[model samples]
Target: MSKALLVIDVQNEYFTGKLPIFNRDASLKNILKAIEYANTNGIKVILIKHIIPSPEAPVFAVHSYGAEIKQEVAEQPHNLIIEKHLPGSFTGTPLEEWLRSNQIDTLTICGYMTHMCCDTTSRQAVHLGFKVEFLSDATGTLDLSNKAGTIDANTLHETILIVQASRFADVLTTEAWCQL
Candidate 1:
C-alpha cells in the first residue's frame, strides 16, 4: 500500500510569540523526526498550510505571518506543499487529487490545533476511505477559555487524541509512526 506523510500546519503562528502552545518545541522535534523518517523511507511528504483571509480587506487579504509554515518545516524541493483554507486539509484543496495521482492509500498526519484541523482532517481521511494514522506527540494546541474559565491545551489535546483513537484513526507516538 502506498503511504504519504501529511504534515499539517506546523506554522509560525503556533510556535512563537503570543499564540504559542504549551510544548511547541517538543512537538516540532517530533514532527521533524516524522519528516526525516518519511524522507528516508521514500514516503511522500505533503505539507499543508492553513490560510485565513483577513475580514476588512476581503479581496486582498494579508496572509497571516503565523499561518505560514515555520521555517523548520519549509519545503525542501522534494516535498509537496498543499494550501488549505479550511480546517480539513482535503476540503477545498487539491490534496485528494494529488493523493489519487500518487496512489497514496495510507496517510500519516501530524499538525497543529489538535482538536481542530488535525482531528478534522483525520476524520475526513477515514471518511474518504483512506487509512489514517495520527502522530500523537507531533500535534498540539493553545489553551482555550470557555464560560467555565480556561481549559488546559494539553488536556484538550490528549482528550481529542483519545477520542480519535477510539473512533477515527490509530493515534501513535512519533516512535510508533517511524516504525510504520
Candidate 2:
C-alpha cells in the first residue's frame, strides 16, 4: 500500500503564537522523526499550512508570522505543500485529488491540535476511501475551555485518539509506525 505522511498545520500558531501545543517538544520530535523515516522509506511527505483570512484574526492570519509553517518542518524536503482554511485538510483543498492522482491509498497523519485538524483530516480520509494511520505521539493539543466544559491537554488528546481508533483510523505511536 502506498502511503503519504500528512503533516498538518505544524505552524507557528501552535508553537509561538496564541495556541501553544501541549508536549510541544515531544510531539515535534516525533513529527520530525516520522518525516525522516518517510523520506528514507520512499513515502511521500506532504506539509499542510492553515491560514486565517482576516488580517485582524488573533492567530494564523494570512501572511502573518503565526500562519507560516514552522522552520524545521519548512526546511524538510516535502513532496507538496497545501494551504487550508478549515480544520479538515481535504475541505476546499486539492488534497483528495492529489492523493488519488498519486495513487496513494494510505495516509499517515501527524501534526498539531490532535482534536482539531488531525481528527478532522483522519475522518475525511476515511470518508474518501483511503486507509489512515494516525501518529498518536506526534499530534498534540492544548487545554480547552469553552461553553461545553474544560478539558486538559492530555485528556483531550487521548479522547480524540480513542475516537479515531474506533472507526476513523489506525492510531499508533510514531515509533511503532516507524518500525512498520
My TM-score estimates for the predictions, one after another, are 0.91, 0.99
Per-candidate clashes come to 1, 0
lDDT of 2 by residue, 26-120 (tens): 99999999999999999999999999899999999998999999999999999999999999999999999999999999999999889999999
Residues 84-174 of candidate 1 have per-residue lDDT tens digits of 7788999999899999999999998887889889999999999999999989999988899889888889899999999999989899999
Q: In candidate 2, which residue pairs get closer than 3 Å at backbone N, Cα or C atoms, i.e. clash?
A: none
lDDT at 125 for candidate 2? 91
lDDT of 1 at 178: 84
lDDT of each: 0.84, 0.95
- What is the alpha-carbon lDDT for the whole of candidate 2? 0.95
Error of 2 at 102 (Å): 0.4
- For candidate 2, the TM-score is 0.99
